[model samples]
Target: MLEKVRYEGAYPTREKADEAVRLVLSGLGRQLTGDERVDLAARLPWEAARGLTAQIPDTRQLTGWAFVKDLAARTNASLATTRWDTGSVFAAVAAHAGPDLLTRILHQLPTGYALLFGRAELTQAA
Candidate 1:
């Protein structure tokens, strides 16, 4: 799945793909509550689940922009690249975790995060 996402993202190597997935998961881990994180991890593939469940600092809710900024800082990638990387990684996540879990995740996050997960644009009322 990661390899497929890597190809979709046109990333040059598996290591780069792995790093993107790690960066996204690390940032996501910090945004989710413990239970939400565990739920998400359970829905992911083993390696991806391990990445999500790895020991890390406490989580705090962050807006979508903050999520992207955090990932950029962690990966030392430009914000534009971070956006693309996030989309790629999340596409894989959406495919693996399926719609029900994805919807739950979107509800847990602030509004703008849906776009990163490749969901339809959210209206103000959403």
Candidate 2:
């Protein structure tokens, strides 16, 4: 999964990819409720799941832009890079978790989050 993130994210090295994944997961973990976090963790690879389940700040339901902004702050990366990294990491997540789980995850997040997951942007009605 890290390899896939590295390749898909076009990171120069595994360490960079690892950092991106950690940042994204850690930030995302902070955004998800306990049950949602556990469900997401169950769908990830072991190491990645550990990251997702790690103890951190209390969960807060952030909007999509807030999600990226939080990730950028955690990673000290530009928003554009963070967005790309997010998409890459989430693509790997979606591939591993499959459609049903992915849909459940998406439903938990704000509308625009689907784009980061490599899915079409959710309409306002969604």
Q: Compare the candidates by lDDT and give the number of the best one.
A: 2
Model 1: per-residue Cα lDDT at residue 26: 72
- Each model's lDDT: 0.81, 0.82
Per-residue lDDT tens digits for candidate 2, residues 1-126, read 999999999999999999888888877777666566677788788999988878574645788788898878876779999999888898898888788878877887876788888888766654
Badly placed stretches (over 4 Å) of model 2 are 57-59, 124-126
TM-score of each: 0.88, 0.88
Shift of residue 70 alpha carbon in model 1, Å = 1.2
Show the colliding residue pairs in model 2: none
Candidate 1: regions farther than 4 A off:
55-59, 124-126
Clashes of 2: 0
**Residue-pair clashes per candidate, as listed?**
0, 0
